[model samples]
Target: MKFHNKKKKSSRGRAKWHALMTIIAVLMVVGTGCSVGFGQNSRKNWEKNIAQETVQVEGLEGEYTLLFLTDTHVVIKDSEVSAQEAEDQESRYPMFVNAEGVPAEEQFPEWIQYANEKKVDAVLLGGDIIDSPSEANLQWLKEQLEALDMPYLYINGNHDWTYPWEYMTDMGRERYLPLLEPFMQGNTAFQRLNLGGLVILGIDDSTNQVDAQALDRYREALMDNRPVIVMAHVPFMTQSALSKAVEAWNSPVVIGAGNFGGIYPNEESEKFISLTTAADSPVELVLAGHVHFYDRDVIEGEKNVPQVVGAAGYQGNAVLIHITGTEN
Candidate 1:
């Protein structure tokens, strides 16, 4: 589907000016002796917010590093839209800024620069890279990701595809598939990338449910006999993450959990969870982001799976994961 692009030059200029003014205003506040905590939020100090962790696989043959980020919530309005739609996009800008009032549009490039500098094996974007499926946002996301020196996998987050005015339904997701297909590699629902000995599996659970087709692909990935790491938008239900999500959002926002005023898994989602958490499952770790906070929990089974939920990228949050295998 073709997206409307009108008044591109003027719209982009306005967006840039608006962002510049925001940064100036924040600097003014900090200069006026306001205790807005600019120390940690300084633009040059954004790297201080990145969190790092390392995982070891018993039979793995080499070491690979990945840069994981999510929930960037980038908002850009470079194409023609309704006044109300433009206002909606503008309203979301402040919601995703760093403490220093730097927007995701600014922080995202920095994150990519870090990945390129570190030369990580790959970049895992857990989803919600854009605030919505606006043409401007999608174009910006594509440009940033394509410029990366290494391969990157991007999954869908709830906000990436749905417009603020539309209800999130299966049909709604299908409507945007063509626009999103270019970044999804081959499949918009599920994707897999093999890094020689370690495999990274990306599944789109942005709608809080996994497609039956995705479950089939997941099973195939499991048969590869390589250590696998699953990445998705929503985190699975674990007691710790559940409690934290409730505390933070005052609702159940996870997947595979029974109905409790939150999203309940459908048959496919239930089966997907069963396969991932099975006693003999080969999933070594799960990485996700949606709760907008950092958390780690072990999904209980005969063998527990470690799950790491990353915080929001708009706040300059990122996770540097080091995967190392036994030496040959």
Candidate 2:
């Protein structure tokens, strides 16, 4: 009887050891391609806009480096932790740095410090500024970014402009515009910003629709015939290695022929990709974020312009685009 008890105890010991090993193996693969990725599904039911012939870009001024950050997903709360906070502790990454996790309010200062060190001419936020569009969340993010000494621009993602899985429509987007109005540099859906000789055309393609007004701004910027940088929350196409690999194991349903790989794959997005892939677009590079990983793809027709999707902004990863005669 004593021998039988001893054997059972030894078996339990081995089981515990195996479990520990399994957890360690998972940690090793967490940041690699084998991990599960997250992003909102595409808005296929929404009305699609047809793409018009893209205009040419005006002559651009001197060279500059643009600091691009996206998918920061900052969410701040009082000291008292909620049920969501408890889940965040386990699911959110690098909790040690974030302390509170998710938004990691404490880490904002560090990001700002890094931007200062990089001395970028401008800061571009590629959306997912907050995990959810709550008043407190938006206000906190605005205050943190407003403190930055340099000019910063932003665009909204599905996570920022609408409730999760919400329909893609003008009324849907309008509901959340107010949440971002405090920090919106321009009241329009898209911005044609001229920083000295550098021209930036930012689009609020959160719902996958770049309405007529936004497209008009894009044309005006193109009419300048200068080098323009296109900034958006999600990639313009589903043809990316990063998306293909992640979709393999993470979430297979999120990407496909018609689907834009977890982003809005509507007519506007297709047109943007088709147009910007040419030499006449003058789009030096495209910076976007949503999949929470860093990936780059060369435009099919225009080998010169590259589209760089950065890693999660919350993890201190940023893409530095050195706009020059050649691609970086």
Worst 10 residues of 1 by lDDT: 39-48
The CA lDDT of each predicted structure is: 0.85, 0.62
TM per model? 0.84, 0.67
| Reference-based TM-score, model 1 | 0.84
Error of 1 at 67 (Å): 0.5
Q: Model 1, range 1-328, lDDT digits (tens) per residue?
A: 1233556766898999999999998888788645445643444445538788888898888899999999999998654987877888878888988887787888898888889999999999998988888888888988998789999888888888888777486676678766887898868789888898999999988878885668888998898888999998999888888888999999878885566677888988888788888887889999999899999898766678999999999998999999997555
Model 1, position 244, has a per-residue lDDT of 89
Q: Per-prediction RMSD in angstroms?
A: 13.4, 13.7
Q: How accurate is candidate 2 locally (lDDT)?
A: 0.62
